[model samples]
Target chain A: MSEELDTGFFADWLRAAATAIDREAAHLTELDSPIGDADHGSNLQRGFTAVQTALAKEPQETPGALLLFTGRQLISTVGGASGPLYGTLLRRTGKALGDAAAVPLPELAAALRGAADAVAQLGGAAPGDATMLDALYPALDALDAGSAPGDAFPAAARAAAEGAEATVPMQARKGRASYLGERSVGHEDPGAASTALLFEALATAYGEGA
Target chain B: MAGGEQVGIVLVSHSSEVADSAAQLARELGGGEAAPVVGAGGAAGGGTGTSSERIAEAAHAVDSGAGVALLADLGSAVLTVKSLLAEGDQLPEPARLVDAPLVEGAIAAAVTASGGADLDAVAAAAEEAYQYRKV
Candidate 1:
């Protein structure tokens, strides 16, 4: 099988992301109900719908534009810590994409790394903060450590899932969950769960037995 | 308020789902005021997939005639917008971004933009809030 990251695939990736979030929005909200605002599902659903609308209307000329547009859509539509943190990650990563509509696997890995780094900086937290970084950071690290996308993606997904689950034992220190203190311990971090969903979407799209 | 004009708000986040939801909440919270929200973010992986191109794309989306305020989530993204401005990038004039607590900054910026405040003022408020959140 040929391995290439093209514009069509990139567009499909956004669609996949939207679909994944929509499918899991309810679950995310359910998790949040226990330890944070119970609006995770509603929040992500509305934001992705806006992204779908924005992308459909403008139809980016390049893959970079597609990613950038997606990022911008999230930033413009979403609020809360996830809004800015996620927005910053995409915006910075989109900026890194430049004019190339298609990228190699290595390049894609690098781009993912750039995005994860931006998000980490924005949150001011690390992998164990019971935040999305717990999932995202490990994924990037795996990719940076020379794992292939097919291999790296699933590994990242597993890592993310584990990371989200791990949040169950840890206290929150970032975002709204931080307000809950010890109460935040039992519940899975909503952002990490969402991050896991993102990886699952990608894994389904690109990491399926490649 | 220009007799009930629509305020163009720029939304920034990491994922499409999160950004979309945040924008919807903003609209719902905005009540009767019509808010035209725009969005941007890093790729889904959590870091910025690209930088200049995405900011430029978002900048083009802004309406120059209406007030536009940018709200972002993370540190580098704020820096990305700053870099875009520093480079004399091709973006709508009279636009600014808020680099503060993501939700608070966004709500404040949207409110100010919908009313009498210009994009600069809204952005300033958001930025100030962002600084406060860091501490």
Candidate 2:
């Protein structure tokens, strides 16, 4: 199989992400109820559903275009902190991808690194902040260490899942949960969980295709 | 007056009602000749959320050649505005995201803008509101 990713790969990746978010919506909301507003799942589901609909209605010819459109959709549709953070991730990564019709594994890794940095910059949250960065930074690190895109995704997904779990004991330093101070401890961060789901979807899509 | 025009203000919040109310309060506090105030809040369709598109639209609507000062409430509101600003081309020159308490910052910015203050002055006014003590 080719190691490069095309627009079709991104479309499938987004579809998989939508499905996974839908499936885990309730669990994500449950995770958020304690520390957050309990709307993470619904917000993501709504955003991803809009992304799915937009892709179906007018599909883009290039991966960058597809992801840019997806980011815009999420920014407009999703409410709360995740919308902008996730939107910035996809949009900045899409911008880094530029106009290339297909991107190789190494290029995609660089784009993901840029995306993770953009998310951190936008949210002002670093790794271990009990936020999405907790999961996203590790996923990016794993991807950076991998040899190829298709093979790297599973490892990245595993790292993201572990990173999300690691947030269970962290005190939030940003976002609404931070308002809770030390009380935010002991609850799994909803944003981190959703971010892990995003990596998992990527792994699932690439793994099945591979 | 820095550029012969009043600086504009955009109020961002997760709730549209809160944004509109804040804008109204700021306008009242600033009195007549208040710089144009735009409320960018909630989802585009409605309900609780912040929309970058809406914020951009508001920034454009209020741009009077002087620049804009954005006052945001909550985490997502700030993130969305910052992401929009990072995009570079979407906002006019001198557009700034003021890191301050939303209501107080909006009021202070509005009052400053109404006096034909420059973007920097309005942003500073908003930032100054951060130190407001309510005893």
Output the number of the DockQ-best candidate: 2
The clash number for model 1 is 64
The candidate scoring highest on TM-score is 2
- TM-scores for every predicted model: 0.63, 0.94
Q: DockQ of all candidates, in order?
A: 0.07, 0.73
Report iRMS values in order.
8.9, 1.4
Q: Give the TM-score of candidate 2.
A: 0.94
Measured with C-alpha atoms, the lDDT of residue B119 in candidate 1 is: 63
Docking category of candidate 1: incorrect
Per-residue lDDT of model 2, residues A1-210, tens digit only: 478898888888999999999999999999989898888999899999999988889999888888888887887778778888888889888988999998897888888888888788778888889998999889888998999876689989999999999999999998889999999999889999999999999998887777
Which residue pairs clash in candidate 2? none
